[model samples]
Target: MKTIIKAPPRRKPQSAGATTNRPGNPATGKRLPYGLADCVIFLAIAIPLLIAMCATGRPGA
Candidate 1:
């Protein structure tokens, strides 16, 4: 009988304070603004919360 073992995947090491997902990629010093998709998503979630707050006593009410 034989058993097979799998090794865990390896990950690249990132320096502390990694800002890969920030408004700008600090690591590469590149400016990247939010795309239209990001804006749409923000609005999709924000609008519902705003509407719920305005029409009700409070959130989860």
Candidate 2:
């Protein structure tokens, strides 16, 4: 006598509208307020360069 084995059923592919099972929106809130910190950091790096350029005179001179 031969034995017959059946495979388990497969799950359906998730639909585009199936967000309920997904995690909360990645951009739910102001996750990265990029203004103040970015400006401060940019200025922190830029102001020194600007002062150095002014103190050293024109470039390639």
Candidate 3:
């Protein structure tokens, strides 16, 4: 029989000089810049695949 071990949940440490209620920190609130960059990168890869799929639809046109 094997025993299962569970890890403890991680907690975020509060900044010394920063306010915990501020909107800049991603761990505490929304991160627009990072989210936008991620979306752009995803679209960059997806667009090429979409174009390739469309181009191949004409049976080697």
lDDT of 2: 0.83
Better of 2 and 3 by lDDT: 2
TM-score of each: 0.40, 0.38, 0.38
Model 3 stretches with alpha carbons more than 4 Å out: 1-34, 59-61
Residues 1-61 of candidate 2: C-alpha lDDT, one tens digit per residue: 8999999999899888984754477666546658788989999999999999899897677
Tens-digit lDDT track of model 3 for 1-61? 9999989988898788775555665577545567878899999999999999998798757
Ranking by TM-score: 1, 3, 2
lDDT tens digits, residue span 35-60, model 1: 88999999999999998879886667
Candidate lDDT (C-alpha), each? 0.82, 0.83, 0.82
| Residue range with the least summed lDDT across 10 consecutive positions in model 3 | 17-26
Candidate number with the higher TM-score (1 or 3)? 1
Backbone clash pairs for candidate 2 read: none
lDDT of 1 at 52: 88
How many clashes show up per model? 0, 0, 0
Give the top-scoring candidate (lDDT): 2
